[model samples]
Target: MDTVIAYLPSILRGTWITIAVALCSILLAVLLGLLGAWGKLAVSKVANIFADAYTTLIRGVPDLVLMLLLFYGGQQLLNDLGDYTGLWGYIEINHFTAGVFTIGFIYGAYMTETFRGAYLAIPSGQIEAGVACGMSPGLVFGRIIWPQLVRYALPSFGNNWLVLLKTTALVSVLGLHELVWESFTAGRSTRQLFSFFFVTLLIYLVLTAISDVGLRWLDRKYSVGVRRA
Candidate 1:
């Protein structure tokens, strides 16, 4: 108990790092998803092909394999491109950057599908009605499409967020010093692996519990005119 108490600060710091990484990854995923959804829905064949390829390739690969490949292989590719183009010198990729980009890029595919489906679920007639009302395209989207898109997307978004939070543990493999890495180090040093891991497990449960509550609140907020069965 004393040892656990003593390591509390370290664990908290690691937890903070974990949260930071996860938030950044989610933001990136949302941005990519919006863009991918737009690309897929666009009239351009090139855009559709590109969006399809991106989603297919990302979804097909295992996350860990993609992470490792992106971290190591991407670094090599960047350096090679730099050397070839004479645009810059050899560049180093930090684990934090690598981790965030990898997780975000990987999950962006899932988000893309979520967003695309949500957008499609909106009735085209509503959009047409908005246009008939003399609403600009942007205004039409904001008033009609965006709200429903968010409502439809929230469930899948919440699920993706939960999974993304758990996936942050993988960053430890890159030596990012997040919760899992910190817990593993403390346990190894104290020779109390079970104790440390038990604490880690509890913290994760708390995080997910809090997330569930927050997500529910959002669901209620967005579901204001919606009637449930």
Candidate 2:
């Protein structure tokens, strides 16, 4: 208990980093998800092919492999470009950026599928009705399609988010000072491996609990006026 109290500040700081990484990754995931969904649904063969290749390639790769490949590969690529431009000594790829982008890019593939399925679940008639009522395509999507997509997508979106949060732990391998990395350091320094790891477990549980509550609220908010008999 005393040791845990002593480490509270460290843990909190690390937890903040974890949260920031998750938020940034989620933002990227959402943007990529929308674009990927649009690409998958587009009539152009090139767009469809690109979307299919992205989802398939990303989904097939292991997360850790992808993370390492992205981080190291990106660094090397940047360094090579820097060398060509005579700025090799000045170029650096920060670990936080590497972690956030890697996780976001990997999970965005899954999110694309979730969004596409949700969009498909929406009835075409509703969109048509909106069109008949003199709603522009953009307005119809804004007022009708997007709302239902949110409601229908919430469950899968929440699932993907939970997984993404957990995956942030993997970024510790890249030496990011997130909770898991802190826990590892504390355990090694104090020789109280179980105690430190147990603390980390509790922290993760708390994060997941908060995420669940927030996602549920979002789900209900989006489901407004939806009736069940």
lDDT of each: 0.94, 0.92
Residue-by-residue lDDT tens digits, candidate 1, 58-168? 999989899999999999999999999999998999888899999999889999999999999999999999999999999998999999999999999999999999999
Candidate 1 lands at a TM-score of: 0.98
For residue 97, model 2's alpha carbon misses the true position, in angstroms, by 0.7
lDDT of 2 by residue, 69-96 (tens): 9999888988888888986575677889
| Clash list (residue pairs), candidate 1 | none
TM-score on alpha carbons, each prediction = 0.98, 0.95
Candidate 1 Cα misplacement greater than 4 A, ranges: none
RMSD of each: 0.8, 1.5
Deviation in angstroms for 208 in model 1? 0.7
Name the TM-score of candidate 2.
Answer: 0.95
